[model samples]
Target: MITFAPGPSKVFDQVGQYLQDAFQTGILSANHRSAAFMNLYQETETLFKEKLHVPEDYKLLFTSSATENWEIIAQSIVESSSFHIYSGSFGKKWYTFAQHLNEATGSHKLGTEDALDVAGLEIDGKHDLIAITQNETSNATEVSQELLGALGEKYPDKMIAVDTTSSMGGIALDFSLADIWFASVQKCFGLPAGLGVLILSPKAIAKCESKGESGRYNSLSFMLENAKIYQTHYTPNVLGVYLLKRSMEDHPEIQVTDALVRKRMKELETVIAQSKKLTMLVQNSETRSKTVMGIAGEELFIKEFKKAAEQAGMQMGSGYGPLKPTSFRIANFPAITEQEFENLLKFLKEY
Candidate 1:
């Protein structure tokens, strides 16, 4: 069935052909240390940097999942305290994970009604790292670029780490806003759920070196050293990396993809706004996520809506966390074609 789930939601129509190419070229069997594998790795990094507009100085590394980056940041980057700003479950989980490593960990929970106003929020001077979720997958809320820029200016000394799990590939992000940015491939990258992309600014690298903590195999220093030569600290998901490279090559310009997503978002939002039975979970229009749209309605209506959509040959995402019974989510990733989205919108309008 066609899927509108938030993650692992859809794969590009050409992904199967790319997989076949990988297998024919024996890339799937190549050793991580082999020249062929290193070339593939370097090509993937180069494409990601060029397409995503990542800075030349920033380093790109891969991990098992975005969750792994949370552990790495706590273990290798934060020395005294880490402050998390969150409005959803994943962000809360990241803060709780940091608390286990640093006793001085703190958090700021943004109210659902308040626009993300980090410039007005007071952060403790002792907090060395400021963590922000660029997109909250659970509630379909987003942190505005203006707020991120304001935080970067206000706290230049503090490391800014952003979680862009659901928004990364489909949207264009200003790389200068955060010292460290990470996302899993299962979402917007239109790949399977085995790899995470971590981009680190030079400031982040210095923080890791200055901290002088190095033991884990995935530590920043170790990963950086291996990444310099286009390699990983351990064996990685070669197939997933190959798929990501192919996806990037297909849509080489991020701005073009971002525009497509924006157009589709406008279409979907218009339909959602006009729906008599459905309402947005994110009340503020400015904060609603472009990549993942969350809709709320009566329990019976939601159940019937999902059931009818499924019967019409579509699989939609159930609402995350506490909103599960009253809401549902739809992914607006690049992998979803305009025709497919139009079909879904038509179904919603008719339902």
Candidate 2:
């Protein structure tokens, strides 16, 4: 099937070869502490930075999944408390998780259809970290980076943690706008879901240092110490790392891919706008996610829409969270080809 399930969405065409290369080259069996593994990790880190335009000074850390980083952040990065500003299920989940860890954790839910209005929100001053989900995958909305830039300026002392699980590598993210950024690879990286990438600014690193040793297995201090030598605090998914490196190498810089993604998103907007039976879940164009397009239809039509796509040899993404049964999603990631977009667009136009 032509998969587009938005996260484990669509594997890059070359991943099969990368997997084979991993086994043939013994990367699948390489020890995490071995020189081979270290070199592979270092090279992948370099490619990750170069491809995504992540600052050289910014540190790239790895975790099991974006979910794991939530704990890592709460445990290691937030010394006092975290204030969450969000609009979707994933963002709320992060807030709930933080609150579970630190009772003082706070939240402000923005309108699902509005762009992030950081200037308007009354954020408490005592929170050490401000958590924001850059892309609300469940609702197909995004927090504009322009607003984030303004937030950073307003609270230079507060660490900004952004979860870009669905938009990372698919869009142009301003690394400097936030102190800590993280994403799981399955969505846009065109890979499996075993690994997550956490990009941290130097200020975040200092905060980790100030906390000293938390003695936790996934403490930023312990992870950073190992990461300095191109290693992990524990055994990692070697094949996943190798695949991410090879997949990223297959593409050009992020802007090139970002342009393609944006163009396709526009096409998606056009097709959905012209659809007699379908409408977008997000009304505001400014806040809609370019990578994940959630389409609303009658509940019956939603089921049939997915069924039709499946019969046509396409694996459409089902709706997430509460939107399920009435909405469906389309992933506009780089791994999906222009021809696939054309095919899907044709199907969409006809259906």
Q: Write the per-residue lDDT of candidate 2 for residues 1-351, one digit (tens) a residue.
A: 898778778888898888888889988878899999999888988987899999889988889999999999999989999999998999999999999999999999988788777667777888989999989889899988988999999988899999999999999888989999999999999898899989999999999899885788898899999999999999998888889888888889999989999999999999999989999999999899999998999999889889989999999888887789899888998889878889999999898
Error of 1 at 268 (Å): 1.2
CA shift of 262, model 2, Å: 0.3
Candidate 1: tens digits of C-alpha lDDT, residues 1-351 = 899999877988899999899989999999999998899898988897899998888888999999999999998898888999998999999999998878789999976556777657888999999998889999999988888999999988899999999999989999988999999999999888999999999999999989977878788888888888999988999998989988888885889889998888888888889999998888787888889999999999999999989999999899998899999999999888778888998998888
Global CA lDDT of candidate 1, please? 0.90
**TM-score of predicted structure 1:** 0.98
Which 10-residue window in model 1 sums to the lowest lDDT?
111-120
- For each candidate in turn, the TM-score is 0.98, 0.98
